[model samples]
Target: MIISVLAAAVAPGAALLAYFYLKDRYAPEPISMVIRMFLAGALVVFPVMVLQRAVVLAFGENPFLFSFVYSAGVEEFFKWFLLYFLIYKHVEFDEPYDGIVYAVAVSLGFATVENVIYSLLDYKSFSQLLFRAFLPVSGHALFGVVMGFYMGKAKFHTGRPLGLLAVSLAFPVFYHGLYDYILIELKRYWIWLIVPLMVFLWARSLWKVNHANSRSPLRAVYSEDEVKLPT
Candidate 1:
């Protein structure tokens, strides 16, 4: 990838993610935390990518079904593990809104690496890379957004957290499976299904965070000194 084209493709999303990490300017993680989150995501993704490939091989010609399995079952599972083990109990993860930002950071980090692979391996031109970068890349981030939102809810609900977490995972899996089905099996135009579903998930997560938790990511982070991060 040409350096300039790569910058053009990555900059917008990076900036957007950073801005949100900063909490629409309300509160932002330390730049180092932001960078750490990004790296955590990228580093974690390598193994997940390998798992995706292995699962693909197992499914062979029916790549889409296993594609769904890999994406929902494997990739999201690790990201969730990252959030749970590292982010969940941390001081940084205190507020409900914190969930959305950290989740997005992790997801975007994965997306960033995934983007480079797709760009370098799949595309011949910078423009093609730039165009496709926005959608699938954002898709990954948004998928995390969905997962994070619900996670925040489950963390605090205490009343019925497991059910909430289950829904959170199930919803994303279904959404992810549908998205892959469109792109690989059914034909990509059906991807419109992905957009609306993503929108709904985002909206739902935000609603839960805003109404249920009512704290920003910044406050959440600072709040964690007492909370101890989950191991």
Candidate 2:
């Protein structure tokens, strides 16, 4: 039972990581660094949980405050801080698309740990695990894509770069906050609103992926490499 729960919890994040990692066609980041980022993300969950417990004790779980401030705000801030401070200027973060790959790695790492804990402590059925895989795990991946898109734009674009950097943090917090807000406040009615929000997130995340890929300085070089391949 433990092994099964572990597998169920880990699979969704691993699958999302593979999808984003494959999207970096031009210049793939080193596996070592990506794993390092994933570990870094996983390690932060302990500190975040402590902080969130403090918030809950202080605020007494007002739904809005708990959803936005305690959950989304705190989580995204840590992920953004890690990306901006540690990974932003690294040599492997050379292309715009690399941002998405690394950010998704970190986000999934956090999600995977959270999922495992939730599964072990509260899972009532396999169906519940499936539901979490569909919403919460994928939601984290989408949020990471949004965060990374702006970070890439900030790093590569010259005009109003600071604004883009601000969005890199602010946008994810807003998206994540609203996502949790609906689930927390609306309760059983959350499905009605969350579906539309999830659709928007998927649409927007795909557009960002394409935009970041197009902006890659190495795209032309990748094209050249493809051309040189023997038929």
Candidate 3:
């Protein structure tokens, strides 16, 4: 039972990690560095949980503020901080797609850990497991993809770079906050909002993945340059 629960918990995250890993067509990031990023992401969750607890204590569990400010804001900030301060400047991060690869690694690490805890503590039924796999786990991946897309762009861009950097953090926070806010505050009616939101997130994430892959500098480097002479 324990093994099964663990497998169910991690399956969604593992699937996402695989999908993102395959997306890096130009230059794949080193496996060792990806593992380290995943570990770093998992480790950061403890601190985030502590910070969230403190926020709840101060704010007294108001679902509105809790979902938006404490839960989504704090969680996204930590994940962003980990990627920005640690993984962003690494030598391995040469191309734009590397951002998504590492970011998804970290996000899945966090999601896997969170899922395991929930599954172990509350093993209700198969339906719950399926729901969590698709919802929370996939939601984290979507948020990571959005954050990484901007961070990837920021790495190559010059003008208004800091603005892009800000969006790298802010966009995920807004999306995550809205996601949690609907589920927490809306309760039973949340499904109506969640389905559309999930659809939008998946569509946007896929587009970002394709855009980053297409814009890879390695592609140009590897392909033969075809400059036409004046005729």
Candidate 4:
């Protein structure tokens, strides 16, 4: 029973990670590095939860503060810090799309562990598991996409590296804050708003993935002759 619940909890993150992993079609990151980042992300959950508990105790759970500051702000900032310091300069991070690959790896790693805890505690039903899979797990992956898109640009392109890196961190925090805000504050209308938010997130994430792939220095270049009429 526990094993089944754990498997269900882990499946979504693994599926999402695999999806993003395949997106790096041209040059996939080393399996070892991806696993390393994933484990690092999982390890941070302990400290993050501790800090969140301290913050909640201090602030007494103001909805706005809880969603934006305690949850999104703390979570994303740590992720950004980890991605920047740990993976950004590694030899394996050689292309634009590599950013998305690794960032999603870390984000899903965190999400998988969180899901397991939730499953063991509150969300035992099948419907609840489905809800958690599509929303919380998928949400983390989308946020990672936003963060990685900008990080990739900051890494490869010379224009405005600092600014782009700043955006990498800032944008995910804003999106995540808004996402949590809808769930925490909207009460009855959260369902309506959340669907549209997820739609927008999926669209934006797809664009980011494609755009990052396009910017890869390893991307294939076509010659005019290669495109000339076959006749």
Of the candidates shown, which would achieve the greatest lDDT relative to the real structure?
Answer: 2
Model 2, residue 40: C-alpha shift (Å): 1.0
Model 4 scores worst on lDDT over the 10 consecutive residues at 220-229
TM-score of each: 0.79, 0.96, 0.94, 0.94
- Tens-digit lDDT string for candidate 3 (42-156): 8887888888898788879987788778988888888888899988888888888888898888888898898888999999998899999999999999999999999999988
Of candidates 3 and 1, the better by TM-score = 3
Q: Cα deviation in Å at residue 198, candidate 2? A: 0.8
Model 1, 1-231: lDDT tens per residue?
Answer: 367656755665696586556553335456676677778988987788787788778776475666567676687787788887887778766556666777788888888877766765666776676566556776777687778788877776759688877765766676667666666765746657656766776676456545534544454565675488565
Query: Per-residue CA lDDT of candidate 4, range 1-231, in tens?
Result: 888899999999999998999888566889899989988888889899999999999879998899889999999998888999999999999999988988898898888999998899986488999999999999999999999988998998776599999999999999999999999988999999999999999999999899888777776533344567496
**Cand. 2 Cα-lDDT:** 0.91
Q: With candidate 1 superimposed using the best TM-score fit, by how many Å does residue 2's alpha carbon deviate from the native?
A: 2.5
Best by TM-score: 2
Candidate 2 ranges beyond 4 A from true positions: 229-231
**What TM-score should be assigned to candidate 3?**
0.94
lDDT of 4: 0.90
Question: Higher lDDT: candidate 2 or 3?
Answer: 2
Compared with the true structure, model 4 gives a TM-score of 0.94
- Sorted on lDDT, best first, the list reads 2, 4, 3, 1
Global lDDT of each model?
0.70, 0.91, 0.88, 0.90
